[model samples]
Target: MNGTEPEWLLWAREIQATAQSGLAFTRDPYDRERYEALTALAARMMARCGGADETALLDAFRAEAGYATPKVDVRGAVFDAENRILMVRELVDGGRWTLPGGWADVNQTASECAVREVREETGFVVRASKLALVHDRARQNHRPAGPHSIYKLFFLCELLGGEAAGSLETAEARFFGRHELPADLSTGRTLPHQLERLFAHRADPSLPTEFD
Candidate 1:
């Protein structure tokens, strides 16, 4: 979710997946061409809805066909002087202490994505200083369990500026260490071990950044 890929990529994938599957079983070349047109429509939808670079749109589509998966949304791991991680009480899952972040938008850089997600969820302005880590939400061997396929992106960000304010997406915005995690955690959004790993990055800079 920390990259432009999610903005249009998900929509396009869903569309093209269905269209390509439809085209493959059909014997008529005319219908195949029509399915091809559907694929193009899907790509254009990604370009318009995602606002990504036009020239890269088809390339993005072509790149996806061979052993691909859905784009994982991005999340932010923001910490403060108290060694506590910032948490949001999300509205979608009945309010929990997950990190501040959402799906990546088309126009922003990955760092910009980290900043946007934090600000939107916590009402805190942060400057992303590091490309801390990337995580795969699907087939999460590193994580204990899984449901839907997803990828998770975590960034190490500094609190550059802002006050803690809540919005429609989040209710209460606060900072907590490992001991203070909320009981009603939105696990669909984040897992406890992922938070722990983010803290591990903060505690030891020498740890290799990871993606899985």
Candidate 2:
């Protein structure tokens, strides 16, 4: 759950995680029933407060079969020779700009996921050179809020050969200097301060990786 979220949302997330983990390991039928009820309660709480559909939330929660855990999202920070940072207009977010990234997929390391997300979203071939930041999404001021707790991995990437091209997920791709970053950022994915921190890391690679 996000630290910025209201207490009710945190309570709902805690309940859902507890219920999901319990369902994964419980052996007694009565315990299973109790967990199921708790799951329903969590879904109801989320739907009522988060403005999401109860059935959909329930289905999403029930689909998980193991101990609930924070999801991982990866972002690639690719800087041009002019010290401009690469950004993409996310079609899903109504063309708002963000660093090239998305949810980390299984079968790939976190750095690999960052590289893949950059390539997929911005057509930028890059190699993740350093893990710059490991931040809990809730700790970061992202909005309008999400159901699952997430860990965002920010990587400093070395640009390889590639041309800017839009993909299904992004409407356009370009680079911007530090002072020229777009105002309409996809806050759910990236924040201005995070970008500023990435710029600082670029300026001084010896800076230790930031984590929370």
TM-score of each candidate? 0.67, 0.97
Predicted structure 2: lDDT: 0.93
Weakest 10 consecutive residues, lDDT, candidate 2? 1-10
Residue-pair clashes per candidate: 4, 0
Q: Clashes in model 1: which pairs?
A: 1-72, 1-73, 1-74, 72-151
- Tens digits of per-residue lDDT for model 2 on 60-104? 999988999999999999998899999999888778999999988
Best by lDDT: 2
Q: Which ten residues in a row have the lowest lDDT in candidate 1?
A: 139-148
Among these predicted structures, which one has the highest TM-score? Answer: 2
Question: Model 2, residue 49: displacement in angstroms?
Answer: 1.4
Model 2, residue 176: distance off in Å is 0.5
